[model samples]
Target: MNPIDPQHRNDWLLRAEPVEGVERIEAFFQAKAYAMHRHDTYAIGRTLAGVQSFNYRRSTTHSLPGQTMVLHPDEPHDGHAGTGEGFRYRMIYVQPALFQEVLGGRALPFIEGGVTGDPRLWAATDALLQQISQGLDPFEQGDALAELAHALAAVAGTAPARSTGDFASVRRAREYLDAQCHQAVSLESLELAVGRDRWSLSRDFRVFYGTSPYRYLTQRRLDAARAMMLRGVALAQVAASAGFTDQSHMTRHFTKTFGIAPARWLRILNGARATEILRNTAA
Candidate 1:
């Protein structure tokens, strides 16, 4: 099959032909950018120099030096230079199915800001950030690809074993979890919803989504609690609104996720506390 050259490189200076079975990019991109278009694979990249600006999820995010950008599959977004110097970066494409092999029935991992500064990802992706023309031997190439998938899941807070082609199960599982996050969702119920057996589904879910079904559900609740808390909702109401058993449950999940309880997270988030790195957006 002929490789597609539908890349919107006019926004930048360099564009390389798509490698068969691999969609890779390398560029010292100057100038500006075109409209956003979604890709079918995991669009993970790193900004080597300058600033990469992108309009993603309705916000203008900047990828300064030493930041990694992870554009989830089919997420509509646009890109441009974030500073006067323009931007230089490289990206790799990964199919969710491959990730599913690791996470059977789980939602796709979403790292907010579409940018990351994780040491693991930074170390794993160093080579790919070079000019896309730097060729890799077959084994090394395989390692890089595997490392990327693992790195992504790791930063997203998962490390499932065996991920290779589990997209459908994971998607189904994700939809189910997202819908029933506030309710009691059992593994048996999820199996019925996604039409996959329980154990494989659980394993796959953890790998691709970077968390177990329980964890994802908890994260959703925590997300809601954060939003409600920001709006000055009562603590009890925030707990109920987030589907937590009570303020204590919400506090437990909040503490585990943010490394502090709800009150502390709020303190840091609101700048009332001096500790830096409030939220680990790498998740």
Candidate 2:
């Protein structure tokens, strides 16, 4: 969704439906927005107005309009407005596996200090960071991701690593995991499926996918849970359907990954929907 009426003056967040491992959000917060939390995706965005401040890597950093913020996956961070005026921004959360597709088993790129004024990054992220309501088609999204992956590598001064492992087998394993994420997937089963040893496959999975196989599976399950929640599924039922043991099991991971409880997330999303409805009615 696009930004809400500024005159309303309440914290609101609008998220685009996740598409091919990419998700985008536009949000405005008057003060503190999130508690310290980490997620297994790269958060790349730009502030649209006022000061966007967050604690990352033991220090507080601020992003203003025209600056790009590149927060590495699984890094602890918290968000708030740097001033009383509040902050507005748009962010795209990209699964590291998508970047691994471009980088080809290399280490993920990282921008130091969590924020940058680098023009290359700004340009690369422009397409993906557009209004959340204006979703990208598959081809356009693929091209934008390619540009973003390369720009991230360049701006971070990261040199390409030589191909050193069983990329083909790792790819097979990834595909298998994706297709079977809703069920229990074990390392032994993965080994049998990909024809690779469990230990070696585990290593290659991290090198090639930027996360452990278990974490990857968990994220996929979380993705399913979110989509189900948006469709008005009960939390307990969503947990069961998404392969979690129970509601509390899902709640722990959900809060850890998104930095908010499921109920609060729904509230903010519902508020955004209501605001959109109001805007349309007024128009």
- Name the top lDDT candidate: 2
Per-residue alpha-carbon lDDT of candidate 2 for residues 137-176, written as tens digits (9 for 90 to 100)? 9899999999999999999987777467888898898889
Pairs of residues at least 3 apart in sequence or in different chains that clash in candidate 2: none
Q: Give the per-residue lDDT digits (tens) of candidate 1, residues 1-283.
A: 1111234222233333333335565554454543565544577887766778888798988887777788876566776777655666777766565555544434566777788888888887766555654665556755676677677766887534444646667777877877887777787898899988877877776556544667766766766676688778988999987788899888766655533457744653355112212333333
The deviation in Å at residue 225 for candidate 2 is: 0.6
The local distance difference test score of each candidate is 0.65, 0.88
State the lDDT at 63 in candidate 1.
85
- Which model scores highest in TM-score? 2
Off by over 4 Å in 2: 1-6
* TM-scores of all predicted structures: 0.50, 0.93
Model 1 segments more than 4 A misplaced: 1-13, 16-20, 102-106, 159-283
Question: How many clashing residue pairs appear in each of the predictions shown?
Answer: 15, 0
